[model samples]
Structures are given as structure tokens and as C-alpha cells.
Target: MSKSIELKKKAAEIRIRLMQMIHKAKAGHTGGSLSNTDILTVLYYHTMRHNPMEPKWNERDRFIASKGHSVESLWCILADLGYFPSSELDTFSQFGTRLIGHPNNKVDGIEMNTGALGHGLPISVGMALAAKRYDNDYRVFCLMGDGEQAEGSVWEAAMAGSHYKLDNLVGIIDRNGLQISGSTEDVMGLDPLDKKWEAFGWHVVSIDGNDIDALIETFDKVPSVEGKPTLIIANTVKGKGVSFAENAINWHHRVPSEEELALAVQELQAQIESLDSKEEPCHE
Candidate 1:
């Protein structure tokens, strides 16, 4: 099977796993997690060079989940990658479980504790700057929600990233449009967001966040310029893959009922089967 096809299948499986985790926990940022699954899948599986066994390896690339509410997808990916026991997923959000609703630094493979809006980019900037100061080659990746753009700290970090010329820093915005309330534009106008980033002196690129192939291609060539931070505005559906939840604001943090979970899984399983069938046979 081709790498793209394999990643596509893996993304579908990740969506299914995240949905199951949310359903079981009865609390999660459903829409956002679903939207960002493809981006995280591409990063963990293909882009970032990190060892699951060595969670604190100094040379490994770091990822900060800036939009920390949507952490179900990340937890599932971490477990499946052997950073922790896959069985630990069942205790997500339960009493005493390290797998909380948000990304926790206590967990293996997690760089920092994040839940409050607008803090991730700043921390990521520090990590990236530290790398440059120490002459290390590690990169820092921060994933933020488009809604989180309203946070002033993000822009501050943006300016700092450029001023320091932290080309090793990559910031990705999950531009799903909808947030906890409603449309981001209605909440806080972020039109011409790309232009604003450019004005801050960072290289920006916009692409389909749900397209695995596009994600792979884009991540492979980072810091496209020699002395600027890279920002990827990943346009994605609010609830991708699942038919009923797509673009539905209620699904932002709403727990899926038993019936809804069943239907969502059915749709995702069909996607996995479709990708499996598309694999070309190998010949000697």
C-alpha cells in the first residue's frame, strides 16, 4: 500500500478511536478533536521525528497542543504509538487517570500541560528559541484552534517567533470555523488571518486540514523560508467523517449518545474498508 493510502486509513481509524473515547468518557471536545485528527495523525505518524519509548529524549521534536480541549485524538494516538499502555485509554477522564480531558505533561510523550487558551504558542516559542540558543536541531510544533486566535498572547508569540528568527517553530491553526459558541467570525472577526500573520513576519500557508496527502507534503517541507516561523492555516470541517455531526455546533463539546456513537463508528469503519481495498498488490 502507498504511504498516503496508509496514512488515510490510519486517520480514519484515529477518528473512530477518538469518538469511542469521547463516548466512553461522556465529556470531550468532540467537534474540534474530530477536525484536528488528520493534522495530528500526519505529525505523529509521518512528520515529527520522535521515539515513543524515549518520551523525554532531548533531540526529539516537540509538539504542544495549544487547543488543549480537543485532546481525545492526541491521547488515542499516544497510546497506539506505545508511549503508554493502550489500556490506559479506558480510564480517560476518570478518577486518578493521567489521561485527563486536556493534555497533561505527566503523560508520556506530552511536552507541556495546556488547557487555557493562547498559552501554547508562547511556550512553543520558548522551546524553539531554546533550541536555537543551545544549537540543537529539534523543532517545536504547536496546534491551535482558530477560535483561540482571539487570544492576544498568540500574536505576541507570533511576533517573537519572527523577531528571533525561529525557523524551527511551526504553528498550525485548526480553522474549523465553529467554536464553543458559534462561528469564529461572529465571535471575533479573524478574516485575513493569513495577512495578519504575514504582517507579523511569519511565512503562512493555507490548505485542507483533512487532506492527509496535502498534510504530508506540506509538513515535509517546513520553514520554507530561511529565517521565519511557518504557520499553517489548516481549513477543516467541524466534525469531519461523521455525517450527522459535521458542522453542527452542538457537537462542539456534546457527548454522543449510544445511537450516535454506533452510527459514527459504522461510517468510519466503512472508510477504513474502502482504503484497505485500494491497496495495490506488490510484485517481485
Candidate 2:
């Protein structure tokens, strides 16, 4: 199979694992995790420079899941990549398990403690600036939620990233449209997302976040301009892949019933089967 096809397979499997994690643990940000699964897949499996065995390698690219609530998918990805024992997955969300609801640095591959939405981008800026100061080539990737755009700190960090000309920092916002309370537009208007980023001195690229092929191509074009940070607004469905969950806001923190879980698994199974049936080139 081609590399894109392999990554597609990984994405499907990760979604399955995410669903299983939530279903078993009885806790997780289901919809958001589902929405960002493709982005995470491309970053971990195709893009980014890092070794699972040497996760702390100095030169390796840094990835921070700023919208850390959706980290169930990230946890699954890290385990599959061998950053930690896959067996550790069983303890997820349990009272004593290291795997809690949010992303914590305690996790082998996780770089920061994230869950409170707005702090991720700021932290990423600091990391990127540090890299620039040390004259390192590593790039920092920070994934934020569109709902997180309401945070003032995000914009502050955006300005800092640009002022420092941190071409090494890439900001990816999971513009899935929906958030916990309701639609992002309903909660807080972010209609002029692209223009606002541009005003903040960022080079912006908008893409279909759900499409694996599109995701790969856009990521390949990061830091689209020199002397500026890149912001990719990935338009995605809140709950992708699962019929009942797609665009359904309640799925944000809701758990699926056994029957629902079976159906979700079945749908993703079909996707994996179809991708397995053929090898196709990725880039256009």
C-alpha cells in the first residue's frame, strides 16, 4: 500500500481505538477527538520528525495538543507508535491511572499539561522562541480548537509568535465548528477567522480537515511564508465517521451505548476495508 493509504488505515484504527477508549473508560471528549483524528494521524504517522523510542530527542519536532480534551486519540496514537506500552491504554481514565482526562507531561510523549483551552498556543510560542534562540531546526506544532478562539491568550500568543518571526512554529486550529455549549458561531463569533489570523501576522491556509489527502498536502506546506507563523484552519465535522455522532454537539462529552459503539466500529471497519482494497497516490 502507498504511504497515504497506510496513514488512512492508521487513522481509521485510531478512531476505533478512540471510541473503544471512551466506551471502556466511560469518559472522553468523543466528538472533538473524532474530529481531530485525521490531523493527528498525518502529524504522527506521516509528518513531524520524532522517534517514539527517543521521544525526548532534542532535535525532534514538538507537537502540543492544545485542545487537550481531545487527547484520547493522541493517547492512542502515542501508544501505537511505541512511545509507551500499548498495555497502558487499559488504565485510561481510571482513578489511579496516569491516563486522565487531559494531556499531561507525565505521559512519555506529551510535551505539556493541557486542558484549559487557551494556554497551548502561548506555550508553543515559548518553545519555538527557545528553538530559535538555541539555533535549532525543530518546529513546534500546536493544535487548538475553534471554540478556543474565544480565548484572548490565543491571540496574544499569535502576536508573540509573529513578532519573533518563529517560522518554526505552526498553529493548527481544529475548526470543527462545534464546541461543548453549542456552535462556535453561536457561542462567540469567529466568522472572519482567516482575516483575523492575517491581521495577527500569520500566513493562513484553510483546508478540509477531514480529508486525509488534503490534510497531508496542507501540512506539507507549513510555514507557507518566511518570517511568519502558519495557521491552518481545518474545517471538520464535530463527530466524523459515526452516523449518529456527526455534527451532534452532545457527542462532545457523551458516551456511546453498546449498540452505538458496534455501529461506529462497523462504519470504520468498512472504511478500512475500502482503503485496504487499493493503493492510490496521495498528492494531487
Per-prediction TM-score: 0.98, 0.97
Backbone clashes in model 1, listed as residue pairs: none
lDDT of 1 by residue, 1-284 (tens): 78898888888898898888888988898999999999999999999999998888999999999999999999999999999998898898999999999999998899999989999999999999999999999999999999999999999999999999999999999999999999999999999999999999999999999999999999999867889999999999999999999999999998999999999999999999988877756579
For candidate 1, what is the lDDT?
Answer: 0.94
How well does candidate 1 score on lDDT at residue 231? 96
Instruction: Give the runs in model 1 whose Cα sits over 4 Å from its true position.
Output: 280-284
Residue by residue across 1-284, what tens digits does model 2's lDDT show? Answer: 77888988898999998899899999889999999999999998888999988878999999999899998999999999998888888788998898899997888899989999899999999999999999999999999999999999999999999999999999998998998999899999998999999999999999999898999898888767899999999999888888899999999999988998999999999999998777655577
Q: lDDT at 116 for candidate 2?
A: 94
Alpha carbon lDDT at 281, candidate 2: 54
Worst 10 residues of 2 by lDDT: 275-284
Model 2 local distance difference test score: 0.92
TM-score of candidate 1 relative to the true fold: 0.98
